[model samples]
Target: MSQIRKKWLETVLKYKFNHDKPGSPTIWSPDLEKISRERIKEIQSEKLSVAFDYLYEESQYYQEKFKQAKLKPQDIQSVEDLHKVPVTTKQEWLVNQTDNPPWGNFSPLSHKRWTTDGWMMFTTSGTTTVLPRVFRHTQHDLKMWAWLGARALWAMGVRPGDVVINCADYGPAVAFWCLHYAMSLVGCPVIPCGGMNVQRRAFFINTYKPTVLLCTPSYALYLGRTMHDLEYPTENSSIRIIITAGEPGPGIPSTKNRIEGLWGAKLHDDFGCTEVAMTPLGYTCEDEVNSVENPVNVHLMEDAYIPEVLNPDTLEPVREGERGILVVSNLFSEAQPILRYMMGDWTSITREPCACGRTHARALGGLHGRPDDMIKIQGLAFFPSTIEDSVRKDPELGDEFRVELSKVGDMDRVKIIVEPKSAIPKSSYIDPREKIQEKLKGLLGVDVQVELVPYGTLPRTQFKSKRVFDMREQCY
Candidate 1:
């Protein structure tokens, strides 16, 4: 590494270690997590200054971006000047990767360093497009991820004694690996049950009695239901906490309640993306989990990243406590420290100190899906999460659901496919379907056709669930 690059990395690592408390039971980093807002900004400002200089000197992609904006690295020395830098979008990331095949110039990690110190490479699902954007992280990045993940896990009340069972496929995705390392760091024994089927996973859970279950929210519900099918009731199981990621869980009350109700466990969720995969940027705290009246709050780690809520169209920062798209400027990460990357999640943030005593900003009501996932029907726009919230509210409905949008004559119509609980008789499906349709209509402000499928007919997801299928173009 160049001396300048080495110095920047050392400075970043020093901040991380200085504030980190790996062995703390209550707060992992009291100095960072519970520090005053002014101190947090000061640290961010200092880091931002160093980070911008490093990015300008190292990353060709960021260097060109700075040149195009007519702003030098010194212009963005503080958090106040972040607005001067143009927002980086996923589209730009995809285009850059296409132009510079394989690894993109967006990352500062050079080929030589990546060959020697590279840890892992992760990619987006690329469900809509042909080429998925890829990211390569270094060993230093992994260490940062583990430490940050440990902080998030600790805040969620995870301790050394808790045994965690990770139910992911152990794929290239960042969540499982990050959680695994964090679990190891926290001194928790992890049972890697990735490739196993639901039956086999249930067998392990029943026999081994792991204290914590880690998987996506949909899978948690499916697993809990499957446990019941296998005559191993989840309520009777020893799993006390279900930590979910990859999909919206605790944010949606119905989905959160359903999983928590089924597993007889507390359902906690952390929010992160492929680009900013160093840690769980937003996490559920104990206070948010226990509170019944206020909407669930996912605390944003302000010290690690600067989060801004911007209007989707105007691209301007929204007033505090107002809903807008989430944009983050990652101050951490050795390989890819992104600046003002649009995360595109609909959420409002509040810097109010959480009842758990952490003063970081909280994403009120959690992430409400992305703008790209928003479904427009007859002049009305709503997120798929809204439908999910309504679908999971009914106790008699199954865990899986599909929303199909088609053109009925000249009008846009939505059809929600849902399965009745296996325990419920086929004759009783009509009532639950009607109830779900009514609830959805009230929530979505549009009448939707509700289809009742047989139990186990809809496919369950192990990772992120794809529930919406817009067939309007195909129908036309």
Candidate 2:
């Protein structure tokens, strides 16, 4: 290791995960984090004003949108008036981008601005058929990216001197860079393993022994077992913190336990998307609460985001602790401002302070499945996450598994195909097979046929693992 890396690791180990030990910048500032709920609103209101004005004045897209609605930027001064401005749908943004090639009119910054100041263009990794929704951010926005990410990292227990191995896929996708930037802001060494395959990435973990592994919860579990196949011990590795996002794994009880058990490390969950910003909307803390929801229950960084839980049908605000569709407005987004944008995610929010001692609003059960992710079978509706929680409780099953939704004859059917780990002998699949089927039926209220496939049979993606394969032909 270089002198700087050696000194950085030494300092991190010495400080014991505390970043504010004299000269380090406060990503999760104790003063800011512990501020009153009213004070957080005050800051959000102030920034919302700038975001509103910037989008209305500069972007022809927002100007046209406002003109059609006969709404003025001044009309929505505070977050209360945020409803007056209609929600900008993903289709509308895509149409705008299609009409105006490349970067699209969503960007308030001039074309010259891209050339003058360095800018980064990124898109969401959710879809494949449609043109990916792109976002433009200036060099100044890099600070926002770093700050937003580092704030969550601090809460998740990533320190200044730790070595972070990033396993999330790279390229135009915005996910990996945010974690990379956050690690930089905290003054840690981050290894980019997004390009490498699982085997190579496993080698790095065994050799360098990263203190933190950043990836989807599925990938973390995938790596842990893959390492074992290569005779590399992960439970004895240096990894202490595994911060995961991009999919619903860390929050699912069985899935969470599986990843934690395999790596012998704590898991942290985060929430975000490319359209709003490169940063996560919620941050999980290190506190281990007895409640299952508490570990995955994220603290909404209220200072930077205005989050609202709304009924998807009526668009009316829901009572605290009631599950509803999440609607969010960017408080500090300057380049591409999204106000009162429907997140389409199901969740509940409570303003109650967390055990971690922060006054920020907490996501009650983290992200409860998106509206479209809801699967209907024989008049019963359940999310893939619900099934995952059940499947993971079975120690015989590997993290690499698939949830196939298909139509068999006239009946809608759901089947779970799971890979048995090498540790489980072929002779002993009966107990686990029976147990997994029982768990799914008991937990999810739907009888799912569980098949135990051979050890390395299931597909794996380095990025968001596509677990749900909806094979129902379009009847529309």
The ten-residue window of minimal lDDT in model 2 covers 8-17
**For model 1, where is the 10-residue window of minimal lDDT?**
17-26
Most TM-score-accurate candidate: 1
Could you give candidate 2's per-residue lDDT for residues 1-476 as a string of tens digits?
Answer: 33422332243223222333312333366655777978777766656665666667777888788888898756666666777777776777778888998878877778777778756878776554355777778886676677777878877878877999988766887767888987888779988886788999999999998899989877887788889889998788889888888887656777777777788888887787777745878767777323455336777877667888888889989999998888888765557667777777888888888777788898876786776778787888778787777666666666677888788777777788987767867776555767777878877777788887787888777777778888878421
lDDT for each of the candidates? 0.86, 0.75
Candidate 1: where are CA atoms >4 Å away? 18-23, 426-430
> Could you give me the TM-score of model 1 versus the true structure?
0.97
lDDT value for candidate 1? 0.86
lDDT measured at residue 332 in model 2 versus the true structure, 0 to 100: 59
Candidate with top lDDT is 1
How far is 127's C-alpha from truth in model 1 (Å)? 3.1
